[model samples]
Target: MNAPYADPSVTAKTVSARISPIGGLDVLSRNEVARLRGASGSGLHALLRRCALAVLTSGNISDDPRAILEQYPDFDIQVLQQDRGMKIELSNAPAQAFVDGQIIRGINELLVAVVRDIVYVSTQLEQIGFDLDASAALTQSVFEILRNARILKPQVDPNLVVCWGGHSISREEYDYTKLVGYQLGLRGLDICTGCGPGAMKGPMKGATISHAKQRRRHNRYIGITEPGIIAAESPNPIVNHLVIMPDIEKRLEAFVRLGHGIIVFPGGVGTAEEILYLLGILLHPDNASTPFPLIFTGPRQSAAYFEQIDRFLRLSLGDEVARHYQIVVDNPETVARMMIKGLEKVRHNRLDTKDAFFFNWALQIPLEFQQPFRPTHEAMRALQIYHERPRHELAADLRRAFSGIVAGNVKEEGIQAIEQHGPFAIDGDADIMRALDKLLQAFVDQHRMKLPGGTAYVPCYRVLSA
Candidate 1:
């Protein structure tokens, strides 16, 4: 017997490259650069190195977070201070990021984004008196991160559509995402996503074609990612504006806060986690009257997949959960039409409420949904998944449950913990556990838990019997 073949490890390639920053990220102070280069143990340099490697490996197919690190074990990045501006020095980088000894333009820009956001968040946002524990303060932190990244447009209409789905998806489902994106682009709407592959990449790819056909200029293909997931799911090539939030909670907040509407395609646990997060917020009493368009869409073949999702939501969160989102299957045109109508409603809602189009300030996100969820074995086992609590509260815990499973599946820390302590134990109400087990098993049966054509996926969790 032979071991499975892993991706070829990245041999150290040294390169000293000077490139101009894109999209208003050209200037930085000496203090920021020094912090970026701080020692691996005490400073942001390790985070910066891992994230920079992920950006440089954009468009990669692997889902293992440590795959890049193992390949480029010696790879390191430095922020070189120059008289005029700044430069990046790469010692032992992935050769794929370069072509004939010159770095690819898009990859270079994304690498710069990794540095820019890491520095800004570590020095300015964290050092400032921003409170991550409070809802309003957390939302303010999200706004500051976006404003610093230059993604917010003050005068633009409600057009940025945030696409959410699994990075691991089928061929048919991936194509459906592009078709929906094409329709949205034809209507002149920009796009935002988790900034990885599969459904996340599909809409941007589709919209680019439509934008080209319409000859529309200044289209925004924005991507929002976090540190833990970026290493496994590298940024896709189509993202013109890339922003790295500090954690999964802030990353999700950035999406809802920045986009006018949301489109969800077929996906696995990660997608389910996203759906629950949005529903939990929308189900809040304070947010009952707010209007934000959310649609679950896929090709005709995925009708069953969406049906399973619908059943799980109705069963776990109650039947009324259907009110917050719509399910449209097999009709890209209709999906686009309904989204346009929904966007109009969103526009009028913003106008009537005096909210900004670039960011949704009125949406009330509870502190539970705003705080970062660390998915440890104890955390996974401690989740209260019964229906005795408020529906919104139940939804929040359920969201955390799936979020833990997601971490165990691909996140570096989660994977290592699982390796050391065995699979995470998830104890909940018997019926709820049954529903969750069924849904997750279905994901495995359909090969949604891991990237296609890779190694078979073993369960990362144990559902405790009632």
Candidate 2:
């Protein structure tokens, strides 16, 4: 894969290479080239540059948003409109992305995805008629984006499993995720993840060997990421299919809608946010009968992690919420067996309900889940995390709170906001706030909030439990 490794001794190195497309990114309009070449702040040129850099430094892990840019300050990319389709001209680009004056095949394919998605989103979407306000419209837009990316397949069985976990995790936990992934792969299930390091990358890595052993030719390693989080968690090397959604909300939606089942490994705030988001939607009365298989798993040593997670969920959402997921700790085979068994029910449900196998249209995702929640300071403080509302509603706001922490922890804008206005103030009912604080503290103690060996995490939000 020629994935970039962040060598601490790597002072500075750059490469200039003209890359031709390997995927379906053959042609680009004159306007598209101008858009990529344009220096205007309002144009797509800046976005292309940032995303291209991310692709070039795929496995070079760093939570510091500006670390990569600081390392290769002069990195640049341009789209040249050529007679033979199009060519990408790189200047002062990261040297690791290239080997012997040629870009890596996997990296180049991802680069093509970066170009393809950004351009398609620019031309086809920008006020092209997607009513983002309506839930159905938002879902339709997600559908369109996936369709354009060729993510949607017809007449396929339900086997794609969405694995969720933190980029920052322990070695044992990471290895455990791979074992579970390998087990699933042996049973012919493909993998999808947030597409970054740690748990996200481990499963795909393990599955590749199993798929090879089983002679599975068309195994898909899909990575779903958003621009805001991509800087912190760049797409891992194993991802053959990458889709960058417009926002985190859309990205989360893509995960739930696309996968037949989901497996959650031990993780931190971001993982908590994903858990809450899916649980909130599934708790909806309309989705009560949906046969979505959800599992929480990890190694034997990580048992306490799941215990804490289960306690938090029960405390926050109640005993009924536990029905939506099973806790399968330390047994990778059982986890796989349960998911495969559950998938059979999912297949039966989809067939009985007359729903498509590729996308889960039958699941009723409310407008609250679809709508984007910008984690501004005021928004954080304004979240109604108390128990006076419906469980699902509280879950939604709780998800937002954790999401805000994720932003502060890694996303550039979130970090900037914290530096400017101090930590976000989160006030809620006394018990809820305390429970929240406890869970967050556990994440910090376990080094789940950020990748271990980096800077110590400071509190990004003050929990006002009074």
Candidate 3:
């Protein structure tokens, strides 16, 4: 069979097919099915179409969120309620997701995850009217979503290592991520990432081979993501478990709660945001004694990248923040070894505190960290990046600042806001702002702001010198 059409701009082919539910979704009620098919302003149909298309085009390398939609303009999806279960009808979907007229098995499972998460969040979570204002409630909501997806295993030991890095990175840096992941897998450690390409994909790709050699059965490659960024960063093919949170805050929280430790690789503003989020939570007086292992590493050539990140963190949050994490360069074995030792401490801490291995209940995440931040111009400008405030509070606002830049860089809503209101305006103390400007400029100069082959990179936020 031939594709119905191939767009010259995207140079991609499309197909249409009906697939049975594979992984998470069982049997949705008729009302649930209708809500998924709904087309109203509040309906989930549009969200479903965009996400389902993203899943079908898994392993796509483009960073532009709208590229897939533009390529498959006529793509649509519908959920049909049947006696036994449900069926998904995909129209004008990406041809790569199918082979010889049948959808790829992995892709099929991911598509089911997309549906399962959407329905669970909208109908079950939202309909219950969760009090988003309360910190505990929000965390519980994240736990419920993950538990519903069967991502949280009570019997499993703490082996999941959450890897964070840029989707756009140099070949050398990417290979380094794989080497680190391969070492971790040889030690029987599992991998969890943001589920995109570049650094996110590299680790999982490398770990698969080592896992095969170790004969590690039921090895978990978890990909945790949110709705806003999934289209831009599709789930990499190696991800065996996929869980989608409702928003970025929850998404970050899910990572900290689920993974035993974290590995930081070379990345852009998004990576900085993750660093700040974790450090801020750890710096809180209540969590000061909690041992969460965090390491920043890259290839030998990328030493300066981590140096700039270290400078920015010290200048903005204070030199004391350095105590929270370590920096290791050009050593994959040492990185894995350190992470394994760190996990041992994490295990002992969990035991002493009586915390569940599946979840980190002892960590105190302030409301500021858990709350969803909307990166509108006004909100971005109003952030208080000052030195007088407490270190953790200052870290929270700084995290939001980088988070806004991330929104402007790749998120759809942030891009639209930037187009309408120009670059976001960030103001702070002169020294901190200067350090931030230099760091972001380095990202631009090194092509960390956007993936290669896109248009010339442009600044999305202006650092107003104080």
Instruction: Output the number of the lDDT-best candidate.
Output: 3
Off by over 4 Å in 3: 1-12, 39-41
- lDDT at position 457, candidate 3: 94
Please report how far candidate 1 places residue 49 from its true position, in Å.
Answer: 0.8
Q: lDDT scores for all predictions?
A: 0.87, 0.88, 0.90
Candidate 1 lDDT tens digits, 219-288? 9999999999999999999998899999999999998999888999999999999999999999999999
lDDT of 3 at 189: 94
Candidate 2, superposed: residue stretches over 4 Å from native: 1-12, 39-41
Model 3 steric clash pairs: none
- TM-scores for all candidates? 0.95, 0.96, 0.97
- Candidate 3 per-residue lDDT, tens place, 169-239, comes to 99999999999999999999999999999999989988999999999999999999998999999999999
lDDT for residue 190 in candidate 1, whole number 0-100: 95
Candidate 2, residue 180: Cα displacement in angstroms equals: 0.5
